[model samples]
Target: MNSPWYIGDPSPSKDESLVYAHGTIMVISWMLLASTGILFARYGRHLRISGRRKLLGDTIWFQLHRFILCMVTVATLLGFFLILIKEKGQWVSVAKDGGHIFAHSVLGAIIVCCALLQAWLALFRCNTDSSFRQIFNWLHRSMGYLAFFLSIPTIFLIVTESKVLPMQQDGLIAILSLWSAWIVIVVILFEIVEYRDRLNSKMGIYRVAQNELMDQTTSLRRKMDHNDGANIRSLNEVKLFLFLLHIIVAISLTIPLVVIIWRQN
Candidate 1:
């Protein structure tokens, strides 16, 4: 007599190793997908900062974004492929150990379709001035965000499921901890970028306040020199200050991600 699903064995028909491999691929693949959200959010900031400098053209950023999206597309497709063929015809039986596994599968399918649509948008992308460009950008961002949000729970369900627990040798608790930590890191990074942009905009007000405070100071012994050289030196000092601040911010923002990646090594 055949054994009952989820009770008898996690991998009755297929090799358990392949299932583990699939899980690993899924984790790495989702990382790529998550990056799309970060890049999309950062696109406007990059453009604003480099609008005049033109460190690189917008097209290059577009291409880079498309490249990552393509990788995500392929990875997601491969995931679906594994879902069907990697199970060795035991797809139905595999669901017996479900605790949102089916929900994860359904969300994965939806995300894949969303990814393909975004890819199609890129292929026929409109000019920046065109009316359709805004629509395309909005839809692209919406889909990307939706996919990212749904992916969290989906990943959690798949990674922490009882059947999949044995696959992660590092222990399920650690894996989930890393996932939660990564999400928090992503949010912190986004907030840092947004904060930087807002601060730059308000620097004018800050400068006025500083000048007022300097005017009120009675302890100044000498008259201030506003010569070209002094101005240049002051500008350079401000630039140096901002640059160091950014370096600190960048390091702080990336530490968690660095730790996670290093842990993987």
Candidate 2:
């Protein structure tokens, strides 16, 4: 008896199953990566909370982060292998064109390389001196930019190839791709703005009324030991807003991963 859910012969069904599995893996890989990125970026600033504290104060959190990194790396490798296997017999000369195939290959390589670099930095670059740290920072910044640049092509390939090759269109795939792309763009823009602000501050040109007020308060504090409650409250508010933003974005990206699995079952 033929399975009602079977859409074709065994070979085609097997191929379809492989593609579906790869798609699912890709979704998982991206979600894990996004989560790791958010967590690292948010708490990374506090890695050195106290001057006397050594290497990231929270050992448990660091371990969890490392575990997530390992999981993401394994999932990514599996996803890449699946794609290669699925494309093996279907390979054509036209794949070398400057369209979906070319872009996918280039961007996919960049993503893998960036992921490796990130892992290397996290695992090995922790105890470096200032000079080494500066070099690592530059490498990290460059890799991040490259990853964001590659995400554009990655997204293009996913949408274009999926639309053309798949007989059954999955709205969820489209939504997930768009959502992932949107999150990447938002993160890139945020980093750009942050770097620009840092540059302006270093150049002594970025000054606002609030900054001037803070400076005055600092000077006054030197002479009179008094707590500037208003400034402290304002700073706390800014911190709260940033925290909420991080949580919201993290949860939003996580939703699609859950939806995809739910639909699959």
Candidate 3:
């Protein structure tokens, strides 16, 4: 038998075009597009863009979030098919590396299916005030989170185990680590923003409730509303800043990864 390192069963002649296409598409879809869409969905509502522009009566943020995620779904499907075509519709086996390819295939399949299902669920979601809206929201969030987290592992596997790429694993790992750290930091920042918003809303509610119990003048109520509106506008400006920063950071990290993939032999 040949030396262990010389075994070539798994490293067949690969089509570079298909390989590059698959890698680039998947990287853009998950790292850039999906991240942007999720950010808009989570924090865009806090932003009051100029003139409060609306599309079909939905806020600009909601429209952007929906549109980007829909593109994510389409891109994911295209990437899935490209990889399958590259592999001749057969499961990639990496038993020599502790079944990494098999695991990646399984996890990737789950992520793709969840992504598609997410779009479908969005289409069928009940109206905001419907009694069953909560159920749809729960399921949609659960599936989206599941698919996103699962993709992390699958992405690592592609670099660490897949023999197709000639890129350095350590370099890829370092990049991914930094990218993930940025994501965590961004999430924490948004959490703080959201908490502050909740606190402000609670305080406003308390003031309203207390006023309702006492004799309050119309002018006094109008003044309170004006103050509240000013506060919200300021907070929204902050959220808009964060959102733009997030997009910049995401694009900065994603570009290097895509370049690395494209540069691979």
Candidate 4:
């Protein structure tokens, strides 16, 4: 009798089950949850809802980002221990297996460390008005970006290189590849939007100078005020659209990968 989840064995052995559980947890915690958290922190600043609510003296975006990241830290720790226990606490020797395992292990360790460090930094960050606040922000952003960059390859190694549970390698690879491309495209779109905003601001300043020289300051001021309001609204709409699109796409891509992992033999 074939079980819906376990194709070859209705009852997988303990180690195999551990591997499956670890993989699924990681996919959800990092790929889905962490990605959403990071995206919200980056692109959700201008969102109307962000400032409308507060928790723990922080806005919605900050609260959501912090909560999700804290959950990722816990989930990551759990996944790490599960694998370590499966190996009986024996560290993978890079010398013996100087391949994907080595890369994955090193990268995974760094990512985990970054996660812990980020949580610690967030907890003890200086107040917004403090002079040291900028330093804290820089350190936090740097570590986060580093962890995010490393996790991509580490996750690829998990699906393609793990030995305990057999996976559909080609399918997973294709999915990850497309997902990576999607992330890159979304980031580029954001950059383009930011650039456009800066360019418009410069042009507006130039127009102000020209209007003043032509003794048209009053009319120009009225027109500029109206345009500024419209632009703010348009910018907000664009950002909100992107944020929602990202969430939808992230879930869409994550679901297939998770389902594949769950149903793997």
| Best model number under lDDT | 3
lDDT of 4 by residue, 1-265 (tens): 2222222344654236676677778878877788888887887665555435456676777888888989999999998888777767776765554467778788989988998999899889999999999999999999988988788898888667634225676788888898899889889887777776777778778977777677675776898879876886677678778878877887888888877877766
**Candidate 3, 135-167: lDDT as tens digits:** 998898888888877877888877775354546
Poorly placed runs, candidate 3 (over 4 Å)? 1-14, 51-53, 96-98, 213-224
Selected candidate, larger TM-score, 2 vs 3: 3
The CA lDDT at 31 in model 2 is: 50
Higher-scoring candidate on TM-score, 1 or 3: 3
Question: Can you tell me which runs of candidate 2 are displaced by over 4 Å?
Answer: 1-12, 35-56, 59-70, 87-98, 126-130, 162-265
Output the better candidate (1/4) by lDDT.
4
Model 4 segments more than 4 A misplaced: 1-15, 50-57, 94-98, 162-165, 201-220
Question: Which model scores highest in TM-score?
Answer: 3
User: How does candidate 3 score on lDDT?
Assistant: 0.78
**Residue lDDT tens for model 1, 1-265:** 1322122253455344444445555566565444543454443333322223233554444544566677877777776677567545554433364645666667777877887887788789898899888898898788887876776677666545554443332454465566557566655655565565566547646755676776544333122323333443444344334434433543443344334322321
